[model samples]
Every structure is written in C-alpha cells, then in structure tokens.
Target: MRIVQEFTKGFWKELPPFKLVLGLCPTLGVTTTCYAGIGMGLATTFVLVCSNILVSSLRSVIPSKVRIAAYVVIIASFVVMVEMATQAWVFPLYKGLGVFIP
Candidate 1:
C-alpha cells in the first residue's frame, strides 16, 4: 500500500525541491537578461527531464544501498554534458552563468 501510494503521489504532487530556494543561482544570475534566463531554463529542463527518465528506467537495476549515489552520478553526467555543450556553443551564456552551472 505504501509503495503504491508513493508511486502515485508524484501524479498529484510537485517535486519537493521546486518549493524550496534551491535555485538561487538561476533566480539571481540568470534573471539579469532574458536570453540568459532562457538558456539556463532550457539547460536545466533538458538535464532534469533526461535524468528523470534515465533514473526511473534504471531504478530496478540500481542497488538500494547506493541508489542515491547512482542518481547523483547520473544527474552529474547530464549536468556535465549540458555545461560542456553550453560552453562550447553558447559561450556568452556560459560566461554569464559563471559559478552557477556546477
């Protein structure tokens, strides 16, 4: 019952982090310019959606004891990919982001 409840809760509830002040960087640095905000939002959305898909698909394969570590690694890899891509092509946004990407 609890497992079913947990699985169904996401359909109705928002992610916990969004309700928190976890995106101080985007709210501050990226807000300076519309383009910067768009770039940051796109990068964040891509990483988040991709990572969620990957993690949900691999949840059964990942070990219970180290699932959090596995998730972090997965998210980190996506973040690195986004960062590298941003730096390579969107140099302006990359420079604007500064310390926020990592």
Candidate 2:
C-alpha cells in the first residue's frame, strides 16, 4: 500500500508545466510570440531532461545537506549550455528569450 501510494503520488499527483507550474515566471516572460515560445520550450525541455538524468545518476554520491545546491549547479550548467547554443546558432532567439534564459 505504501509503495502504491508513493508511485501514484509521483506519477499522478505531480504532473509538470501544468499542475506543478514550475518556472512560471520564465514561461510568462519568454512566450510572448509563438517562435519565442517554441524556442524556449525546446531549450527548457532539453535542460530538464539532461539535468534530471545527471542528478539522478549522482544522487547517491551527493550529500543530503547539499543536495539542492548540487542540483542547482547541475541545472545551471545545462542552462548555460542552452544559452551558448542559442547565442551561437540563433542569435535572434537569444535576444528574444532575454532575461528569461537565466
């Protein structure tokens, strides 16, 4: 029963970009136009997936006290990657996304 409850909690109770409403500020800021929205969504998705994989893989090694700091560092690195990629390949998007990229 505990295992089932945990599974349901994680899988059903915590849907993203909707129920959880993570990064709401950036979502509102960058989605002014369709093209900007698409670009921001793609970048955000890439960062999220990559960051999750990396963080899960490192969870065992990361100390409990600094777990959040570690996760932030990992995610920030991916954010920087997205920023550089956009600046190099799509300067317009880099400009359009603006402060929301950070």
Candidate 1: tens digits of C-alpha lDDT, residues 2-100: 988886676445667654555545645666788888888888889889999999999999999999999999999999999999999999989988787
Residue 66 of model 2, lDDT score? 100
Per-residue lDDT of model 2, residues 27-94, tens digit only? 66778899998998899889999999999999999999999999999999999999999999999999
Return the top candidate by lDDT: 2
Where does candidate 2 clash, by residue pair?
A: none
TM-score for all models, in order of appearance: 0.75, 0.75
As for candidate 1, its clashing pairs are none
lDDT score for residue 89 of model 2: 98
